[model samples]
Target: MSDNLAIRKIIHIDMDAFYASVEQRDNPELKGKPVAVGGSRSRGVVAAASYEARKFGIRSAMPSVTAFRKCPDIIFVKPRFEVYKEVSQIIRNIFFEYTDLVEPLSLDEAYLDVTNNKIGLPSATLIAEEIRKKIFDSTALTCSAGISINKFLAKTASDINKPNGMKLIKPEEAMAFIETLKVKDFFGVGKVTAEKMKRMGIHTGLDLKNKSLGFMTKNFGKSGSFYYNISRGIDDRPVNPNRIRKSVSIENTYDNDLSDISHIETELEKLSESLETRLAKNKIQGKTINIKIKYADFEQVTRSKTSQYWLSKSTDYQPLWKEILLDERLVQKPIRLLGLGLSNLNTEEKENQGLQLTLEF
Candidate 1:
């Protein structure tokens, strides 16, 4: 590996079972036991499961009732999001001390692009170790970090070692490392997609890499291109700061599976209506409509289509249903979750005036 390429240092940090761990950490009595954080409402879902609980078939977003059934002794704690946010900020402060190129995926996970440094550290590995030490010293929390020449491999490396650990993937070793990875270990490949690939005999990263981009694109569309690149441990995307979000979305899990198209469409309509209200609230404009669907079997599919019109107008997303057409295919499988988002961002407007808009993705 060329020493010059080392300048492109990236690190991905993820706190271990964040919500559940937080609960356990604050309440010493709960440590080393099966713990899950969420609510007991009929349709409530688990926000996080402790490592102990996870070993017993529990996981985040699993039905609360199912979680209880899986581990009857599971201690359920309500989520304290405000506290989590505070902790997240403390960790974020630590990242900014090293580099401003931090992209937070959630309260407990982030990608720090340390291509350049504030502390003049020569090795990203040293910075990662120091960050872990600071996080633990300050908040009594442990975070794992993955370091590499690019975002994809860096994120993958972070998971290689867990809970107060770090892993480094040199540029030359990235491709070989990814070649041995399971297809399921890939970022974009979820349960449903992984099963689809498995049935196609694409079990490993090398297997996925062997497929022609055209074939993968035909199957997965735009995400196919992402898969093609990441399969070879290549990710050129920058760690963008203050990126404009052109869309906002919310989703709720249902106690009952939506076997009927009417129910699924009803949920979509509600999500779309809420999204439109959010758009108006933010005074943002976007011309793309996106729908995310999760099947009862836990397979997810996202379909989006852009338009020449902005989201400020009602006519923009009304007809998007006619374009993507995944609803027609989802008729056979019951939907467990559904969400809607708008993108193809335009610059923000502070006032309540609507403008004719055109957005390109």
Candidate 2:
């Protein structure tokens, strides 16, 4: 690797159960109790779970009813997006004080490039600690940070000591650390991929490193090459602050299953309007429309159609939404959730404009 690549300083910061922690911080009564942030426990999914709730095996995205079964006394609180967004800005402001090369993965996590920082700091570890301390001072919430030479290692290292902690993977130690890592811990390698790799006797990073680049590419295509490089502690991808949003989606889970066509249509219109607002807010249009339906029995189905031209109008989705909603198999069952999404996004130079604002540091 070139000296420039080997010397880059990247940091990944992740909040500690952001939503649930905010709820606990604001309401003293909720502290020390298992808290799940979302809608009613009867009809929604857990958006976030506090450390206390996680002790009971509760997790984000688990069905609320299932969570209730796991912890009968688990408290469910509705999400306050407005509040969360405000805090997100606060932390982002703090990040900008150090470097303009900050990339947000979500409201709860972001990556920072501080090789050349505003503070003239030589140690990325100190910058990470100061950021964490400032976040606590500003919001009374703790965050974990990982420091490394690239985004992948920084992200993976951030998880090593989570919930108010920090870890640094120096360039010298990167290889040995990655070598002992399990295949499942590799970024972008999900459950099915890990299982497949295991079947091929690739259970650890060492095992993956043993495979020739040609062998991995032959088996996994483009991603195979990525796996080969990252296994050897080599990742050159930049921390792109101008990353584009690939898709926009919104979904709602109803308290009561909708059995009537009229009710379903009304809900679809509301969802369509919401999707339009989101599209306009992001200043982008999409070439594909996808509709998702989850039945009361929890069986979900999705149908999609692509348009030759990009669309920004909400009404453009009505026809396709109606067609998918009225599918014979779907109409036969009571619907518990309805989702509308747009993909193959078309952006008008906004991402490029973001690039123009970049600083070398």
Highest lDDT: give the candidate number.
Answer: 2
TM-score, one value per model: 0.73, 0.93
The candidate scoring highest on TM-score is 2
Query: What digit string (tens of lDDT, one per residue) describes model 2 on residues 201-233?
Result: 999999999999999999888999999989988
- Those runs of model 1 whose alpha carbons end farther than 4 Å from true positions after fitting are 1-7, 41-43, 250-361
What would you estimate as the lDDT of candidate 1? 0.79
For model 2, the superposed segments whose C-alpha errors exceed 4 Å read 1-4, 348-361
Global lDDT of each model?
0.79, 0.87
Worst 10 residues of 2 by lDDT: 352-361
Backbone clash numbers for all candidates listed: 1, 0
TM-score of 1: 0.73
1: Cα error in model 1, Å: 11
